[model samples]
Target: MTFYDRDQELDALRTSFESPECGFYVVYGRRRVGKTALLKEFCADRPHIYFLAAQEAEARQREKFIEKIAEHFDDRVPRIGGWDEAFDYLGEKLATEQLVLVIDEFPYLVAENDSLPSYLQSFIDEQLQNTDSMLVLCGSSISTMESDVLGHESPLYGRRTGQIDLQPFSFQQAREVIGYDIEDAIRSYAVTGGTPMYLTLFDYDLPLGENIRTQMLSPTAVLYNEPEFLLQSELRNPARYMSILEAVATGHTTPNEIAGATGIDSGPLSKYLQTLRRLRLIDRAVPVTASAKQSKRSRYRVADEFLRFWFRFVEPNRSSIEEAPKVVFDGTIEPTLPDHVAPTFEDVCEEVVWEKIRRGELAPYSEVGRWWYGEHEIDIVGLAPDDDRILLAECKWTSDPVGHSVASQLREKAPHVRWGPETREEEFALFSKSGFVDGLADDLTDDWSLIDLTEVDVCLS
Candidate 1:
């Protein structure tokens, strides 16, 4: 597949490569997120040696690493036995030529040899940094990479000159990859959620329903075990994490609600939730107006859209799919798929608004997120404390044209958000999937902005 986004990331790598000094770069993210693809693209035209470690014993890994280096440097170099000899040869070879040595899946190597980071740190300090070679240590294990490679207490803490914590693609990038219209693109994104690997598996020419049935719901499909495989790879106890994720996916956002749903005690649940948050699998959200430290009304949500859809729809409906695929699609998935995409649509709209703010097309809001109080809720809120300004927005995913009532309701709820003692000036923005009703624009004040699906497409473009 052709590379999509990552222009900024590629630039980062290029800058490091062109520098006068050696560079030790760290690249890490969840599995199947295109980490290897990015590194290959970066190393395509350069003199580079890429070693992808496997889940094997330490001795086997060392042999493979030596073989890769020996092949790169040719038979002129002596056969190295271990990392110490390998780094010694690498430092000597780097002095003669500019090279990039990418150790993909570095955590796998660390799992077998716990002292690999210490060896790399010494090599980098003594020899690698003295030359123009760039050492890129990449991994998919979020916890291990963060703690052992980037954490403060790790042996290689201060050795890294640059790092990139690559995330899944955004809706815009995913849309470009899917090459579909606004409606079908939204549906695809609701399921794939910006993951390039998942998006590439779907056939865009076919009906979205059929694509979902084959690519996701089928028991024999490749993606059937994707979420489980990812969880097992990154998590210590996949069952406990799966339960917590299922709880969040089923609308159990609060701690007490998740506890009730999963039957796990609050103490251990907190630890699991923190670990999941650190892995970028789930997020803890508070109201836009509430302080993070002081708010007791925080809610947990699955950060990965695909995982959310899997836990909510696929995993729960396995028996139904196994019995009859068509029946499951027509009876369960087709009917409730929109409900699954509703929250995701809101997220997409919020991202568009943030993009506008980044381009100076919107107000200078300090914070942007969803807000709610008791029974009332707002889809998007942007706060600017210094300027005493607030932006209240509503995102509607329905096909029906949104009328003035929705904007009126947003206006009604703008005052309920308590930012400070003094009243703040308010602005309104409305994002609708099917555009707005007739004459809806005439009522718009100077402070209000109306953005429909077409506008979002253009913003993404």
Candidate 2:
């Protein structure tokens, strides 16, 4: 069975539910990222009412809500009409103890009635204020839901005492959810992207390659067309979005580069970029020292691992994937996926470094990021904020060990980063796929740290 990875989100909601005064909570996320699951799991043992908002007219939704609300009440109320009529009676129905009323996909209800939010806000401020009830508003369309319900100027604004901007599972959290080792979990994250629903389709017992072939690559697979499904819900022109996503997936970073590769002009592309950024599927990054002048060096990339994988492999070769499943799935996409994801290994290294820091293996650093001047880029740089000292890093994904030359090359580029503070204890750290270089352990004396990703005595348990 698939597991949950949101204990903190759960605990925080429960804590809010314990409030003596009335509490309103807003939970929003992208579809299939487990917003409903997190709330349902939290409300499982509690006395709560769950109502799904459909695209039907307001009268129909009111009837369904009334039906759900009746189950939680001591006496059944047959006919229910209007938001004010339903919530006004909720105060008197459960006056003794706290209860939860979850309106799933709350955005639909508000969309059906422009006055719905003001009506609910007025009810909470007036009638519901005297009750022992928790109002749980949950939705999947994040930006719309938040603006309509959770934003500062919203009718439900400042009403929510507790909120969860529920996120997709991180790569580390995926390890627990799927019961995979660090390396294998990274592969899962790269493909399924920590979405609970998608990861549930992944078979942990199968080899990673087999799992990808069976669940992700085949024509009959659920995720084979998952991107298309999600895009249909989120975009006006999925064809254009797919084109833009493909450019990013195939390593087009800047706005100029994406437009050039797709042959789509930048003016039309900016609107699409806004939508993707709002959905959090992609991100725009600047130099760590981001400024307000709208720098031309800004870059864009697909931020989700699964989407990245889909755009890079599945979308590009959809015809080949559909026609020759085994050949393309196993012989093509499988072999090339790792090379596509090598840089994300730097992401794995970041997590590993943080774990080691928490365990006192590596000293803490304020910032860790890639650094470059013009074209040449360094894999990882950790800086001590106080002293402005930097730890230069080299990551090797091959069997070869990182050696003195890597440290030497980084030092050569160090003058370009050109720190304004005194360089303190120039520490060299190497992350190796197989092991460290010979005698480098002896060469380190005591200042350097060498980490081998393959063989570490640290127990994950």
Which residue pairs in candidate 1 collide?
none
Question: Taking the tens digit of each residue's C-alpha lDDT, what string does model 1 give over 160-264?
Answer: 889999989888778778868987798889988878888888888888887888998888898888888888877667998998999899899999999999999
Taking the tens digit of each residue's C-alpha lDDT, what string does model 2 give over 1-461? 44467989988888878878778888898888998888889898898888889988888888877777676665676665677787666655657667888889887887788788898888888866777678888988777787888778888788778788888876666666665665666666678887888888887888888888888778888898888998887776789888898899889998999999988888888988988989887888654433325756678889888889989988878898778867887677767877766766767677766677678877777777666658766677777767656766767766467787776676676666644465564566677766867887786646667777553324232
Error of 2 at 49 (Å): 0.9
Q: C-alpha displacement of 166 in model 2, angstroms? A: 1.0
Clashing pairs in 2: none
Highest TM-score: give the candidate number: 1
| Residue runs of model 1 more than 4 Å from their true location after superposition | 76-81, 421-423
TM-score of model 2 (CA atoms): 0.93
Worst 10 residues of 1 by lDDT: 73-82
Report the poorest 10 consecutive residues by lDDT, candidate 2.
Answer: 452-461
Q: What is the lDDT of residue 42 in candidate 1?
A: 96
